[model samples]
Target: MGPIIGMSPDKKAETPGKQEERVGLRGVSGGPGTLPEAEYGAASPLATSLDRGSGGSEDEELTNLNWLHENLLQNFTLGGAQPSASPLFDIEGDPGGPLNASLSSSSQRDSLKSKPPLSFSLLIYMAIEQSPSKSLPVKDIYGWILQHFPYFSSAPTGWKNSVRHNLSLNKCFRKVERSLGKVNGKGSLWCVDPEYRPNLIQALKKQHLPAAHAFCTPPASPPRASSPPRHLFLQGCSLQESDIDAATAMMLLNSAPGHHHANPCDPDSPLDLSRPDSVLVSSDPKQDHNYSSMALQRCSSRSSSSSLSSLDEGGPSPGHTRSRTRPRRAGSEGFHSDEDSDLGDDRARPQPSQHRSSPLSSSVKRPVGKRARREVTAKPELDEELKEAAGSLLHLAGIRTSMELNKHSAKSKKLNRK
Candidate 1:
């Protein structure tokens, strides 16, 4: 047959030669115009062989193709090459379809990832605010967070414990019991406190999430009456200049006259004006002299009482003496006669004056010993029983002395008889 129907004479002639060349280069057993399996591996052998035959000087093309061919065979045989999963390349005129879809999906994912997680308080506030009756059970709150935020879904189970902790500890959250018929859960439903709702809504708005606006609507406040101008009110109540002056004058006239001198009752007054002599109630010289005399008399009475107290505390001063009766002689007829003579002599003796030394003079002469200091500082009042005991002790001492003297005289009389 003269050249095949679709093949030109040159191609027909060259095809066998090209096939022989390919077979020889690849070192594979195959028929004329057949592709070798070793050259292309899993790739279409026909397409690769056609591309290899299409261009360039044989030596250069063969060198480049051989290198590419070896790499392709290695990758395909080892199962290292992977095909694109996207279908955009296979579709005829819509290459951008899968690419656009991928870009949009990636952008959406990035946006979700970029948003920072909401705080625990904010999360609870959001859940409560979005509830149908403005309250949700703890389980429902947990469900809401997992549903809205994908991050929490894969997070550790400890976050649920955190949610429960926030709900119980936050003062802004309040627990409301379900109605008897409506109760479906074990725990009470949680709601945001009304007083804190406005604050929570404001905080949510600051987050700038569009979803925040839907649940952040606060109730409108009642309109308030406008107050009158302060200046106008003051003008209506203001007093006239003439009336003010008249009021001031009347106040002065009604007030008591002020004393030019310091008041006697004032503790801050430097002088002791409480004394009659210090207070000049009248301008009379005779009344002033009388007040001075009365003040002097008061001073003298106080001094006398002080002096009596000092004398009682210190006993009699050195300038004074106590009178005592002489003890009677024992075992002699002459004793009775001598006792009368001694008593007469004691009575005839001059008594010392009962003079009290000044307090300054007594203190100067006081002894420095502990007992002496104690006696000087002792209270002035002496108990009557104590005075009687002291007197009895003195009397006993005198009787003992006299008995000793009587014994001595008896011994002397015995010696003279010997």
Candidate 2:
């Protein structure tokens, strides 16, 4: 071969250390001395560091250069490029590496996309079951699903139509009538049928979804019992003694003092005083006539002379006069002046037999002024007495008076004294 161009005959072969020096200088300066791209690839950071004479041994420099070369090949390679042979770049050895994390996240997304979402029926069941009333309207159900499942937030409007479709078609769900007075929109409440609840729970278990077991489990507490109906003040009264007209009985009840009006919404509320026709009268006409006659005969035969003497004595004392004005409770139906009044210091005084006569049998009519009537009716106790008397006469004929009434009467008398 001819002598190599640009080489003197006297020049000797360069050593490896001198060759490395020339290459690093060429890399730093971008001079003609730089090797062709095919020979050494791209400029290396390691060469720059070495040329800067960083404080490291030659072996350390060479090791760092090899590391740089491996990283460059691994990161910047084209399609089908072979992986670096260096153990530092081995992803299998680093389980917690960023590459592994990214791969895992992508796989999770794929799995989510491939797995079917919860069924509309199951979604509805969850919404209704979790509610305080175990029922929800269609709109509330939609809100609940969207709140619990983030996927539905961005989902199309078709899902809402599907939800309504599922509610209408599903046998497991049933529609309940909205309460009469409730103002919660026009939609009826939807609830899961008790007969199909177990089947739904079993189906939920079969789904094998995360946290789905919670739904399959029954509620920890039993359903709450509805509030008991309040007892009508006169529910215990059943007056069998007189031929009392239902209207008369109702009037007496309405005249009683201290009556508490029951809740209008309550199904078991007392007889509506506004509608007297609705009052239930149980007295037999024959029995009532006989009882009234017998009672009248007894009163006339036993007390004719005494009644005349009592009336001549000029009615009750002034202190006792206000006792009539005082509010009376339903329990005061059996109250007699001879019996102890709630006021311990007050003594019983004689009253006319006419005043004591049963209102149903009385021929005497005592005209009351509007103001006096207002004052009497305004007293809550009198209203209560009217209610109790009416309740007793209409529904509970022949029932004995309870000691509780006596005690209540006594309590009222004491309060009046105060």
Candidate 3:
């Protein structure tokens, strides 16, 4: 055999086209065409080592891409090279080229390392627990994570979407609607589930924090147990111990004066207890007793006056006055209904003296009695009086007309006879 013909005549006719095709398909199918080994002789040791290193790197990138495809995009097959899963591969341009492959692999590796695989639920729980109210909204949660966790702040986009997704899907957090009084655009409140709180705390402690040693070490000494109970005050006035429960206190805190309470049985009937015009009973035991005594004395006096007024109105018989003056029997102390009814009648009767004595009563309108109320309005009585006056005037006018008619008729008859 004289010399084996290597280059085909058809390929030789279009060498430039062939070279371009080879260059384009270098990484895929086959590598770039090389000079005959006989003419180039054996490759140098340094060159061989460099080539081996590059080949090894390419193999490693392919391995990584395969792993990502399996784990992250399970539906994607390596053969098809789907562009939809762009995070794993760039299917459009040089899918296996070192530049694109290395970049993607390093990025994926760094992200995997940077994100410490901490549970998102745990992160949310920490943010809320550390918040002043032990509650936060979704946007606030995002802010807190970015502020606290450097990894999150440095992370690429889509993290916020992840946060929203986790919040909606996770059962460990509860979304409560804001009160009707809250301003618009102020979103609902997010609270950690009580059942999940313990688990989240444990997870936080177990978290391998590099900064924990610097910040969260245990105290050297135990806290003092002999400390006295403390009291709260505002501008020197000691706040009274509230008789209401926590929920009621919260409702009162959020609500403004004159507005209905947050929850009620009906639209018209409000649940508000501390009205602006109402007189709040003192909570102090000593002051409360004194007030009760004063109120009892006032009621007795009012009742006596009411009986006298009723007697004067119609001049009822002596027996009726005696019956009205009879004091309540002393044996009915234990029953609520008997005592309530007895007090109710005295309270129902209007007394100018009691109303004048109460300072708060000046602002609070005291209820009037049935008779006095009608007198103050006087609509029906005024109408009746006007009607009677008009009738009398009309009767007088009719008699005057009859007298004139009789005189005129007598005069006309005399003239006719003449």
Candidate 4:
């Protein structure tokens, strides 16, 4: 059989149909390094170090579209081209300017004035397509939309700032963490999941002219291959994700660093855990546990990182996500957030980063903290809090299990915690 993700390279192979390469956008999960979650619709962060994009080689053309985006926008005025036949493809066939008919004259413009000219539509698009901006910061699919529509050029002056803020308020955008780096003396960290975006392009097209224009925008790369829906997609498949069983899970834990885990999340490449037959078991029990403990501690410390590694678990419920983003306009009978609403935090996907620097092995045994011990365990009294917390965490109960326990002992640990 041909080599699957995480499997050993195949010298001899057999398959019925001609295998098609999986089409993946460059930054589907986050950017360079990201883990899909399992809570919503994402895969577990533990199963494998999942990249943000679909399957491709390390050196694919879309690997880093940063240079391409930069040159296309900043250098366009300078008329710069890299001695290629075409630099920026004539986006949207716009001969005049980018924006179409303006709302400048109508009451619509006046009403929109209070609301930022920011396109919530674009930000959501970035998250959905898992595309990034020029900086490779969650690679917002916005640029692709901009390139596709090109009409926004004539929109307004403060449009850019409004757009940034629109993205800030977006729960999905916030839930997924990005690397914190400086851009033009300001913060430039970001991450997103295109599959989790509110509504699909076709749906957007049915709503607004501008939104539709932006949504339908496809890739600008010259067509060298015949394919429909030319834009790439990072899919969440059951067979692919569920294939990571317990034994394979153990292998992944072993391979990771004990005190510090780092997975080379190449979105362009196949998922390492998804195909385990090829995995080289290099786990050192001593180090793997230590490494994972520290990593989990670090993750637990970050409030915004709740969904850092579970996008797949939070699967693509585009309809649900769309409902969460209620229309501000009156008479809009869409979903409004409440206890029973599916629009709650459950719709949020985990943050992605530019790189997966370190992930503590979940399989590691941590030094029981004193507080954890005092609150719960008996023999490990010195580290009660840590022990209790660990037990509750392992058991899926909240830290309350650790905090509320009056009597602490190993014997009662299971019954009391459960």
lDDT of 3 by residue, 1-418 (tens): 0010122112233222222221211112311111122111211111111112224333332222222221112211111123222211221122333432332443323322233234566557655544434456777777655543334443454667866655554434545445521244566556554323322322332221211121123235432222110111100111112211111222222221222222211112111222211112222333322212222223223333434322122111222322223232221111011111323455334445654346543223222232242233223343333333333333332343334334544655897799
Candidates sorted on TM-score, descending: 1, 2, 4, 3
Q: What C-alpha lDDT does candidate 3 achieve relative to the native structure?
A: 0.30
Q: Tens-digit lDDT track for model 2 on 191-284?
A: 6643233234323322221111121232364312121101111101111122123223432232223222221111122223332322222122
Q: Alpha carbon lDDT of residue 40, candidate 3?
A: 16
> lDDT of model 1 at residue 232?
6
RMSD of each: 59.9, 43.4, 42.0, 24.7
Candidate 1: tens digits of C-alpha lDDT, residues 25-72: 122222121112332232222112212222333322222223222222
Whole-model Cα lDDT per candidate? 0.30, 0.32, 0.30, 0.24
Model 2 lDDT-worst window of ten: 227-236
- Scored by lDDT, model 1 comes in at 0.30
Which parts of model 1 have CA positions greater than 4 angstroms off? 1-103, 111-116, 179-182, 209-418
For model 3 the local lDDT of residue 198 reads 24
RMSD of 2: 43.4
**TM-score of every model?**
0.25, 0.25, 0.24, 0.24
